[model samples]
Target: MAFFKSRDEKKSEEIYKIIMDTLKNRGNQVYDLKVEFQEGVVTLSGVCDSEATRKKAILCAELAEGVKKVNSDPLLLSEAAAQEQAAAVPPAAPVSPNPPIQTAPPAAPSVQTAPAAPVSESPLETGFPSAEAEAAELKPSPEPQPSPQAPETAARSAQPSEPVQPQAEMQTYTIKSGDTLSKIAKQFYGQANKYMVIFEANRDVIKDPDRIYPGQTIRIPPLP
Candidate 1:
């Protein structure tokens, strides 16, 4: 079956492509940058030499037309990349015999974001298969439709399309062995009895408070 991508889906894909192109085409950054767009949000994924380059790539994409916002993640670091980045960002400030270490202006410190820890074993380690994954995989992959390959392509590709929709936020949580409702409640909601909130929100998968297995994915709900 052809993967028939919806207009919005196609647009999102084109946004991703544009972001990738900008990052790679930039100031001699040769690595293939990756990108994803969801719900009016743009997420940049790839290896860059330094935090500065990653930030720059994100900013360039944000300026691209149809970009709601940029989410920089999977920002990888390698020593070689770091050296290349340092050389690129600050070109030897006037060769003073003793140049003071130029410091970034005082601003809100960037929030620390670490990549998700790799699972030592596959998802099958839990001995339970993913029902949601099974359902998703059953559908025929959509048809590849003609859409924007880049933001510039998209800008002139379509006329007066519907507003880009936002991406659904999928929250994930891992279960711990010997975990009980009260323990989960205490950790997630601050009250042992608050386990009911979690239990209620996840009744679709959680049969009982005592039955949750380690490595299970549970959905947490926002307070109403």
Candidate 2:
């Protein structure tokens, strides 16, 4: 049983570290994310700049070695915002003869919301028709049927709006029998030398690395 348990634990460690490292490199996040893996499943619960990063993080985890499955309900995303940010980026070449513009999907609620904010500063009233005509145009057409493409577009534009702070609340780990600092470091991070990471995270509880013993519980500090 002990041998089986050790192998399972090692598999978890490999999966977690490989995924975190992948995200750090691709996402340009400065620090390796703090991850906790058990069994063959991985949970990602953390803050990221935008929804693109969040989705990319999950995808990276899914591709990691030995990861059986991934749970991303805890993932936080801002898809609309990320898409807008990408759109806002400047193009390298100068605007030439009027080229075809990519119209946002009708399901993109963001275009309406975006134009609303800018409308206060600049007049957009002249382009569209009067209130009654505009309302009619905005209304869903007769045939009263759902568009086949609506669901697919809406699925792509969706983002996580729920708050996700409790992932860190009251969470801590204890040193068990036969565990060493290097081993704990390797489990939490990809490298064994990152034992300093564990030490630093639990500085208040740990007077010295050498003094830690079995059953000594400590707070799992937030990654720097």
Candidate 3:
């Protein structure tokens, strides 16, 4: 059983290599391509230049020996390809020009009557003093009361605060050929599945985990 398992593994590796070479040589334009083969099934994943290119990659995998099935569902189109497809769609027919708007003629200027002159009332007629005389009768406002003084308490000396420790500088790694986040995580943290540590740390640089390129610098955060 062990010998047969070894043979199967070897065959899978060979098929994987063949599919990768075919994609590159045929110019299928599949970026970040990953091929997995198991139990006579080959799965292709990556960003393709177009639907046609994605189909071509699947075909290449199907043509490889020992590949009973090709799964390309995980493949996706590049942003440029998606935009090209959107552009290809015919735009909605231009809306018919709107009819000229009809506006009412400007109204004639309204005539405003002049306000009637205010009638003056003498003190003898209304038996009330004039506003000026009333204002002079008002007494001066009382002076503001002095604010109460707060009781004093004994003063305490200010204690010196501890100096803040500097944060640990995050480590950085330059991507190399065949360097995947999972591999880098394993190298630094001893766990392949902790790739998210690197991904979350370098969100400014990495948009996709599988889309890293050679010579790109990424931050490696310290393990929590």
Candidate models: Cα lDDT each: 0.70, 0.66, 0.81
TM-score of 3: 0.34
Steric clash pairs (candidate 3): none
Name the best candidate (by TM-score).
Answer: 3
Q: Write one digit per residue (lDDT tens) for candidate 1, span 44-152.
A: 7767766667677777768766778777766565678777767878665686587688998899989999999897875435766689888888979999988638887
Q: Estimate each model's TM-score.
A: 0.31, 0.28, 0.34
Best by lDDT: 3
Ranking by TM-score: 3, 1, 2
**Model 2 lDDT-worst window of ten:** 162-171
Tell me the RMSD of model 3 versus the true structure.
57.5
How well is each residue in 1-224 modelled by candidate 3, as lDDT tens digits? Answer: 35455655676677667766776787767788877778888777889998778877787788878879888889889999989978998999999999999999999999999999999886566778889888888857779997854444222233454543322568889999999999998887767888998999999999999999999999988777
Per-candidate Cα RMSD to the true structure, in Å, reads 62.6, 67.4, 57.5
Minimum summed lDDT over a 10-residue window in model 3 is located at 150-159
